[model samples]
Each structure stands twice: as C-alpha cells, then as structure tokens.
Target: MDATSFILPLAEITIAGAIINASVHFVPVGGAPAAMATSTGVGTGTTQLAAGAGFTGLLAAATMASQAGVSLANPVHMLLIMLSGAVGAMIMLGLTMLIGQIIYVYGIGIVPAADKCEKDPITGDIQKPYITPGTTGHGIPTVCFVSGSIGAALGGLGGALAYIALQQLGFAAAIAGVLAVGFFFMNAVLASYNIGGTIEGFHDPKFKKMPNGVIASFVSSLIAGAVLIGMAMGL
Candidate 1:
C-alpha cells in the first residue's frame, strides 16, 4: 500500500535482474586460447551458455515482476505475484529454446573465425563466450545452441522459486540453510561429474560448480515453499 512497502521488493528484484544479466548473456566471445588438451585437437566448451541460464532466468523474472509492479514481501503478496513472473520467464525461456532449436536444425554451427578468450587468472574460471578447439575453429554446434535455451527455461523455474521463497523465511536464514545443504550436494555432484567424465573420457568435469546450482535452487524453492506455508497459516 505504502510506497516504501511497494518499492523494496521491486528494488530487490531490480538488483537481482542486474545479477542475472551478468551471469547470463554476457559470455566471452568465441575464439582461440580456448583450446582443450583433449584428443580432439582444438575445441571449445559451451558451458557458459549452460551455466548462465539460471542467471538469465533470474533477470527475466525480476524484470517482469518489477515492471509489472509485482512485489513479494509477504506470503499473500508473494503468492499472488509468483504466477505472473513465472509465466513471463517461462515464455521468455521458451522463445530462446525455439530460436536455438531453429539454429541447430537449419545450420551446422556458429564459428568464430578469429581468436579471443577470457578467463579468471586466479580461479581459472572462464569469463567469455566459449570457444573450444574443436568447436572453436570448426565453430559451435547446433546441439550446443539449443541447449542454451534449455538452460534458460530451467533458470526461470529456479529463479521464480528462489525469490518467492525469500519473501517468507527471511533472506539470510534461507541462504544459510541452503548453503549448508549445497556444500554437500556440490561435492556429490562434483564426484559424479568426475566419474562420469572419466568414464566418458572427457574433461567436461564440474563437481565444484554444479553444487552452486543446487544451492540456488534449494534456497529459491525453500523460500517459495515457506511463503506457501505462511499463506496457509494465515488462512
């Protein structure tokens, strides 16, 4: 009702939107230096597209919620607004998927003729559009293209859940609980990735990062669930 009440969540979502943009869509361009020491000679990885989807969804949902004057500061308010935001994100995600699918089905792939790569020197984390040696020169594949869309859809769901939940349990506690479970889940995912990658004979490993997704999902879902509980309690 009051401007302050209305503005806070909108502000939060806006901040979240910026975070999403950074995480999604802002990949390092494809090029050389993205070489892998694999048997495939030169190649590139499409992990950024995949990993950045949730962030993208987060932004998309936040943008929709904020623009539409949706707020989630409490259980009833959150419940009322969730469907709208989620639907918007889902639609956006679906469109991305459609575009990606079209590209994959029609074209062979997208190649970056030149060489350019970005990374975090300290962490060895990549920060650019992925350009693997195999895919780098030859270019990115259709499969890779469509998969990016898949990431967006999943991300939308995750973001919707996270923000909705955050409204109920309080942010700090929600994130903390999610982190505790996330650490363990991350280790498990890492172990699985290593075992799977090894058996598959691919360096496509990621036990460390997958847990982040798990945790984010856990936090968001938990928040959403809590809000639902509160609504029931109020009733």
Candidate 2:
C-alpha cells in the first residue's frame, strides 16, 4: 500500500528483466539449423533454452529459500539462495550442452566449428577449415559452451531475483513462482526477437544488439511490475 513497498519490487523487476535479456544474448542459439549440424550451439531458440535453465534454477533457489531457518531478509541468505539458482542453471545448461555435443560430434560426425570468427576465441583453433562448405558452422565449440554456461548463470540469478521480489510483496510461493515464470518468459522472448534468428555466443557479432533487448525488457518489466503491484494491493 505504501510507495516504498511498490517501488522496491518495481525496481527489482526492471533490473531482473534487463539482466535476463542480456543473459540471452550470451547464449549460443543455432535454431533448427543446428539440429542438423549446419550451425553452432544447441538446436533451440534463445528464449526456450534460457527459460529452461532459468526455471530449473528458480526451482533450486525456491527450495533453498523455503528451508527452515533460512531468512530472505538476511543479505547472506539471499546471496546463498541466488547462488544456488545460478549453480543449478549452470549444471542444467552444462549437461544440455554436453549431451548435444556428444550427438553433434559422435552421432553427426561434424567437427566443432564457428563461422562467426576465423579462429576459436578460446581454443585458438582454425574454425573455417573445419566447417562444411554449405553450412554456417557445426557443433558446440568450447567458447560457445562457456558462453552458454555464463548465460545460464545470469538467467538463474535474474529469475531468482524476480521471485524474491515478488515474495517480498507478500505473495504466496505458488503465486510468486507463476509471476516469476511469466516475467522471465516475457524478457526472454524480447531478447529472442532482438536476436532475430540465431547467435553463436558472446563472440558473435549479434551480441552487439544486446542493448536493444535489455532496453525492451526493462520497459516491458516496468509495466508488468506495475500490474503485479496492483495485484499485491488487492491481496
């Protein structure tokens, strides 16, 4: 009912949105082409991949936060909750990339390559020579894997922040979770649209468009946060 109550969560939601959007840009999404070994990264959209990992992290954080003696009001406890989310998300994305890499390398028999750069930014391996003549690239390279994991971590942290803000507004765990999921998807989709199609990771030229996505998410989340505050007032 007070301005402080409304403003705090609103600010948190806005910042979380921006973080989620930026995180999506760090992920390497190769889309349908990647499924067939014609491009780099996991064979999915940025939104899907980010959301998947984010939700998993959210679940982990919620589990930790809900435990007896855990106090969200304590900064250390809050940090631990957020860190749990980040670690959970990283593990989810790591396993996902690992499995995809296995299939890409062993099942499809394609060498890991990135078309965006002449050489692997991390491994320093020649990229172009390994890529198939007709394809942009193939398989999950080391840089892409690292970038995706970083993105997943950010996504988890963002999701946890949103949930914590909602919980602070006095919403029940279930309601706060649903709201957080919706909030995460809204920002994730915005980032995906900004990507326009595909991205290879942080090193990809498409990463430069991240600001556009972050701005869009920030504005959208502000509106969503207002609606949430109105709902909280009723509750």
TM-scores of all candidate predictions against the true structure: 0.35, 0.98
Which residue runs of candidate 1 sit more than 4 Å off their true CA positions? 1-51, 68-137, 172-235
Q: Per-residue lDDT of 104-172 in model 2, one digit per residue for the tens? A: 999989999999999889989999999999999999999999999999999999999998889988899
RMSD of each: 13.3, 1.0
Return the top candidate by TM-score.
2
Q: How many clashes does the backbone of model 2 have?
A: 0
* Steric clash pairs (candidate 2): none
lDDT of 1 by residue, 106-217 (tens): 5534432212224323244452344444533222233223333333443344345445444433444345234323322332233233223211111122223444544453
